[model samples]
Target: MTKDFTPPVRLDIDHLQSLYRSGGLTPRQLLDRLDDYQAAFTDRNLWIHYLTPDEREPFLQTLEGESPDSLPLYGVPFAIKDNIHLRGIPTTVANRHVRIVPDASAFVVEQLLAAGAIPVGKTNLDQFATGLNGTRSDFGPCGNAFDPDWISGGSSAGSAVAVALGMVSFALGTDTAGSGRVPAALNHIVGLKPTLGRLSVEGVVPACQTLDCVSIFARTAAQADRVLTLADRRNPTDAWQEHQQPPKRLMGQSFRFGVPAADQLGLVEYPEAQALFDATVAHLEALGGTAVDIDLTPFSEAAALLYDGPWVSERQLAINDLVNTPDQVHPVVRDVLSAGDQFTAGDAFSARYRLAALKRRTDAVLATLDTILTPTCPAPYTIADMMADPVALNARLGAFTNFMNLLDYSAVSVPAGFLDNGMPWGVTLFGPAWSDSTLNGLAGRLHHRVTDTVGATSDPLPDEQPPQPLRTLQVAVCGAHLAGYPLNHQLTDRGAVLVKRTRTAPRYRFYALAGGPPYRPGLIRTEDRGAAIEVEVWRMPEDRFGSFVAGIPHPLGIGQLELEDGTWCTGFICEPCGMDGATDISDTGGWRRYMASMATTETRQ
Candidate 1:
């Protein structure tokens, strides 16, 4: 790189793709530049095993035929939390004693590599990924991106910092109780802990096997979503990858999101976090969401069970080989994992039963809203402060995250912003299993609502891409069903929203279909002589279209109708025979105006 040439501070996948597409850079040039970038941040503790160019030759050569347009992640550099396996590398879950050589990459890593992403190295993490604070590792804590004095948020800490500090474009992490999310919150990036089993956990070192979800960390929700689309697939061999289909899309752009009631949040002590959360709530409302305060009793209680109850037993099971030699583990992590051995089979069973009960109750509450929004971490803390009280501090970090897998939910953590002290914060959107796509859709929108710049860099987000309307069919309404009219509730109740209010092409004639008190109208396209009847276009979910059409009476049926802009849509049209008795209301532009005139005549009489 030239002395005058400034490298991209944030290797957002899109940014790299655009540069490659425009002939601004190549994979070879980027591979060379990675050396320069990594050299500048040598003290940040970002990696456990960064590969050299000679070591990276095979990985780079694998992208021989791929190009940006053909492969979504073409030439994008990435990192993996050391707990996840990469071929020919040692699988060190941040513990030197437990290192094991892996002959193959993990399932998700294979998929990403196949799509042309370059794996530069393996990153450091909390030993066995057993702590939320990044300080539990034997190698060193993955220090916070902003301040070495602060915590990076772990066990995905180094993965988050790797992306934030521009060492790599994105990274893979494991989330059991906010390991994936808290790091993103603190480091100013995006982390998506998808639905449990939504992405295969085949090669991941299990912290809590049943609860672990392979997660993606990137600079923006859009990049997280891109990685998610490629990674979410069923692995028949991996019992956790259950192959569940995602649920229906949230009604529309509008949604109702739940927040913990005041007493439950307990954020008064952290005024900055509290204020940022309040601002986020207001921001969601501004984006057309209805915020509902909820009783977090069940959720909070479930979070406690993760460490205080028998579920810690699963952590012990994950490292069965290391249990006898406790000295090899980090002191705090060893203490936590050792407690797991105290629970009896009966005790573990009892905890599972209680968790099931909580799941049922929490599921009911989730049903009332599209998502539950919470602070990714209650608050950020310094590395020194966390080390002083490792257990409680680590527990506080998982306050909002520990319940996710217990209840089987999907979540995305997006950057909220930095506070006066220069540390970043984040908010998460989560919902029932299979809500990944919907949650991400809202997450991307909410991300922009808080800040434009990605990660710790100064570059603003690229221009917003206009959302492509869902596959739902568009229908045009010319009568009582228009916005604020008598029958409009039917459309709204069925998840339909007004797209636009425009006019039909000049050749369409309108008629007041001589029906009862619940009146309606009909439109018909004529060859040459009629006005462009006023109409409103609405988009309805494809699933609801059949029932909506079934409700239409005999004379008026859905048929192709031309719009003022020459586009075609499904709209109410009358049968020729029915038009015989129908009174021509074409003189008025639309049914609403015609009805207004009738109301005036009645008042005059």
Candidate 2:
């Protein structure tokens, strides 16, 4: 079978779709190829339960008479973490003693299955999703895809490895404290931990019920984004589910991003990892981002509260019966959850109070930046090393990730580079809640820039990209609405950000309209004689745009105006009748220059 089978080089959503269209591969062929590939990794501890051919047959048969173009994820294969429900499949969560066969799939899983995705199997994880290092599992440690000796970084260990090894196009993993991201860094894949509640956790075993998030593991950020779009559905039945509003696209051609202060960097002991992080910062700068040093004190303090404070009790509450019978749990995970016994109800309230204060501080810092960039994990550790110092080392892996859920942020971890020893490494870009798409877009661009391949595969990165977000619109302002002018606040107060200062196409006439103290300029497209007029382009959330346009007075209205670069955007334009009493100011070049001339005239008088 191995000699006759040749696996597809890439399993990205687009690649799979193209193959299905061209008749190069079918869902059954890919599944058979994956089954053949899995034979070589029997000892890797990547799966807790490998689905039998009978178990996968129904999903394959569902798409038999359907066209590939009918469903968004038609024929895509995905792995489900052992903790999440998959209909009749057993959810062990890496602990055989508490295994339960759920009658229905998770809310997210059902959404994927309905869209024609095949559930390959349930992958291994840290028992009860309690640890950061992958070794704290009853099924044995899941090692890195590149080297079986190293830790895969978990509790999402097997999910990351499956995607990294290209056994599936994507996988579902749950993240409460770095489980999703740490594994991605170690295995070289894209791990997207969307905002809490963005993906419903209706059928998943919870680590900390309030903090648990169903995350996606894929070969590229684009694939992760595609999976997220399909999996994220409004689950009115789940109390914890939230309807996320349309996200604003904050990351653009130029953005400000926060980085941990030099003294607070956790990679001080890992020189190679530190060097890679520095290079990543430089690469972001080259991509039009300004690095701003931010104090990591509040974020670090909040991270400590997750395990050290009463939040651990939430994990205990999630599995009440198992907590009472600690012997059933892995020894390391048992020790960790046992800490919850010491906290009282008072401790929970006090911890919540402290978290609220720290949240304020973090929010203030983020308000000035588009996103925060951090190393996904401090460094890679071997499975032997992880098992030896389980507690301390697992805490180290959560250094940059634990605070995200507590603070309600969206994050995407993408492969950054590899270390000297050939271990993979990655960095995360995170921002306020509902910023999932923006972070994914930025991560995708950065991933392509730093690496040519995805996971451990030799397949080249796909040229086709994820659809760009359209939640914001760009508008150009030539007069009163220009930055520092009287009407500029109208734009700024509506959450608009200045994109750039440029000139319009040399096919417009600029006129100073007859108006009061806060005068306006009128731009008219002229074919015969015209000159470029200076303007400032600003982008604002689409939801706020209607209000911004509604407040415009008389002849000045929003219309498409061509810029010097030939790009058209909504901008201020004038009706021909409004030019009756207006003075031509074309010779002054722009509104700013004309205003300067007026100021000089007033001083001389």
Candidate 3:
């Protein structure tokens, strides 16, 4: 058990695609890696449920009849968190008393099935998805994928292990309070938590409906992104699913990323983790991104609301049956659920009001950066450590994650590096909702820039990306220039693709600059009186973005643009002093949208 457990077998999405196309490995050959994984871990509680190869034979047989192009995830295996339902498999949530479901796959699982991914089995989790540590389960805790003695973080514990051990290509876990993310940090993988409601919640047991997101666990950022974009499908039967507009891509050669102050609790712990994170910041700077220290008071306040405020009521509501009938649940889960009874509806509204105030404060602080970068987890933990004091350990695990869902932000946690103990440490790139794709692209680039290692596989890193015949650049445009709006053809004529339609980082103000052919927005950057103005990032060849920027008139110029995430790119930014006698339109956060809203309001009046 003491022997190091890095799986010799590894699988990555892009590489697997290349392999499938080139015939380096067949679907069946890859599935055999499961046997290797089982042997490597040897009953590591990584699975609360497992599908026998014989049981998966029919799926494998069907794959052989289809062409490689017919199946993107053809023969690729994945694991599911026990909280998510899978047909013919039990959804236990690691609680022995729960009855196995007779039918239906979670919407996310159904989509993966359609993509031709085979499910290995349901993995373990904290009972009812209540804790960050895997140890809370009735089933034994899933050990860290790298070191058996340490904890494999939860509630996505076994899902992370399944991927880390190469048991599957990727795994699905639910992130309520960092369950999806912390495990990835503890067990070297990418954990993608899409904006809330982007992924459907149907067929999954709820932890906290308003805050829960089905997350992906993969070896590389690209794989995680692929799964995320592919899995973000709507289920007609599911009413809770929220369709998001496409993510706005941010364009720039260099970016300015934001980091928590050096004195921050999470940032200061584990000198080595801090060093690794700081080194990553330095790497980004060297690669043309700037990092700035910011006060984390607002973010911390939002995080406190998750456990300290009435939000605990949401968790209580999620398992009302178990709470009312405590005998039906695991002891630890029962205790966790019991706390929810402490709140009333009045407390919920009061918390909401406080959260709104915090959001306003956060928006003000967010106005200064492109994206925010933080350690995925404050520090690592082990099974024994959690058993000693589960609640406190769980709280520490969510030090970074609890606030994200509550604030309605999108984030991606990529493998930054290994800790001094040889366990993994990860960092997350976070931005406001719908900025998922921007963070994904940035994360993909950063993953390649740093580790260059794909998944848990043994394949060598590919050589540098050769220059594209026409390298793309992301450009931010507001006002009559926005897509589908008047004068929008300026970009289409130059072969630009609209990647997303979202707001700027919460840092810029929109102004009705005195005059133009069609009124234009003059984006002025300021210490206050500004919000992240809405804009779209169009991917054009470097030459095209350049030509477009050059044609932009004075007062309306493209400088550096920050997305909701803390990463900066070249976009639209006015001279800080541009507000002279100009009508302040900062409250709107976007020029075109603001003008349209103003026109609508005028009509209504």
Candidate 4:
């Protein structure tokens, strides 16, 4: 049977629809394919609760009883994270003692069933979705589908693995931080964490009730977007769910993407990962995303709040009973949950206060640009490496994720490429809350444009070369005009496409102006005192650049800024007078890069 079953890996939703429509494969055939998937994954630890053939046969038979018009998913098989309820399938959450109800499908699960998608099983996850590495699951860490020795990222481990292994057309997972995203990065799949509260959270166990989100895993961002559309129906039971439409295109030009400085601790040791990330960032600009540098401090601080502060208690609050009962909980999960006991209500309140402040700071920074792109995982670790240092490894994995939920943002992790050693590197696109639709559309385009393959499938998608409108001026901004920074909106609101990041010639000086809610940096041209400043260039519609130029204040005027290698374009510059009282932040180079350095120093202090 294993020899005969060659189920197409990464069977997208449309392909399934075509097969079911042509009578080439029935609901029963898909079920048999799922069985084959189960057999193929002999040691991958991909599933936590698989529906028995008896349980799934009836659903398949019922589909046979109906015509194509009745089924949206038709015979497409999918998997769900055990944290979500599934009728007749135990929602173990990778734990042994959790009570399992026999017939409570999560609202989304019911919606999928109504659309004719068959549930094949429940996948594994970090215990209560606490860790980022898949290793924390009681069912055994979900090993990477692409490479057995590597860690399949988690807390959404099994769902990613299931899809990567051709076990299902798509799967459901939860993202709190990078659970939904990191695993997809490791397994080379698409992970979509919808806008907070966009998808109904009713019937699913909470990791952090205030910030927990139901995420989707699929072969393509397009498929994930479709699933989100189907599951986005109004639910009176979930107050967080809201009706919204997917954005057709992002407005503005010169999208400024925030990238971590090379010196950032997370990337300092992982040079190869850093190189891969740098290349990805360059790719974004090459694809027309303006790259900017920002301080990583506030983000790192927010991440620390998740585990070091009181948010762990929130998870305890969700599954308090199972956590408090000793024998019922997995030992590892017990240790993680027990840490929450140290927190008091005051701690929770304090953490909330600090997080709010940090979020404001984050938002102020993000307001300057359209999107923030970062490595889905700073570095990849193998199961053995993770087992040797579980806590540290886990913490490192969440470096880019823990702040997401805390800040009320949405993110999608898409495959970028493999490291030199063959492990994968993925990039994540993050936007503020309610921007899921926008980010979804952006990620869909990015995936099709930059990535050659979808999910774990070997099939390559044709390159979608983006349109470059002629008669536009590409202006680079090293400071405020960079998106998500305080001044970036000025460019975006005027229409800009972030084109690239190129260093200015060694004749430029960087200054931090004194007494500036949004800090402003002054770039001055000096013969002996200047060094190349790291700045991002954004292309404004030539029609809009003139108006943008008109808004510039004195001292900080627009000029042709020369790059390190003699490339020159219009950008923000300061007169000698502006530097009188300004701090010579030239040593740090550009504004965002300087901010990144400051953030790191502050965290250590």
Best of the candidates, lDDT: 2
**Each model's TM-score?**
0.85, 0.87, 0.76, 0.74
lDDT, model 2, position 403: 96
RMSD of 2: 4.3
Candidates 1 and 2 compared by TM-score, better number: 2
Q: After superposition, how far is residue 279 of candidate 2 from its true place, in Å?
A: 0.8
- Per-residue CA lDDT of candidate 1, range 350-459, in tens? 99999999999999999988789898988888888988989888888998999998888888898887676768889999987766766776777888888877666565
TM value for model 2: 0.87
CA-lDDT, candidates in order: 0.83, 0.87, 0.76, 0.77
lDDT per residue (tens digit) for residues 1-605 in model 3:
34334454446555666777887877777777666557656546887877778867766787777755887787678889999988877777788777567487888888888887878888888888988878877778888877767888888999998887667778999997888888988876778888888899999898888888899998666667677766878778877788665443343455668888767855545788888888778777876688888888899889999988887778877676444466867777777667778888899999999999999887666666657888888777767887888888788888888898888888888778877766678888887676666676677677776675543444444433322111356677777778778768888767566666777777676788776557776776666755877787666656566677777766666778777767666676666456666787877767765777978999999
* lDDT by residue for model 2 (233-319), tens: 889999898877766446656889998965687676567888888889998998899999999999999999999999888888887
Error of 3 at 488 (Å): 13
Predicted model with the maximum TM-score: 2
Return the candidate ranking by TM-score, descending.
Answer: 2, 1, 3, 4
Cα-based RMSD of the predictions, in order? 4.4, 4.3, 12.6, 14.5
* Model 4 lDDT, residue 396, Cα: 83
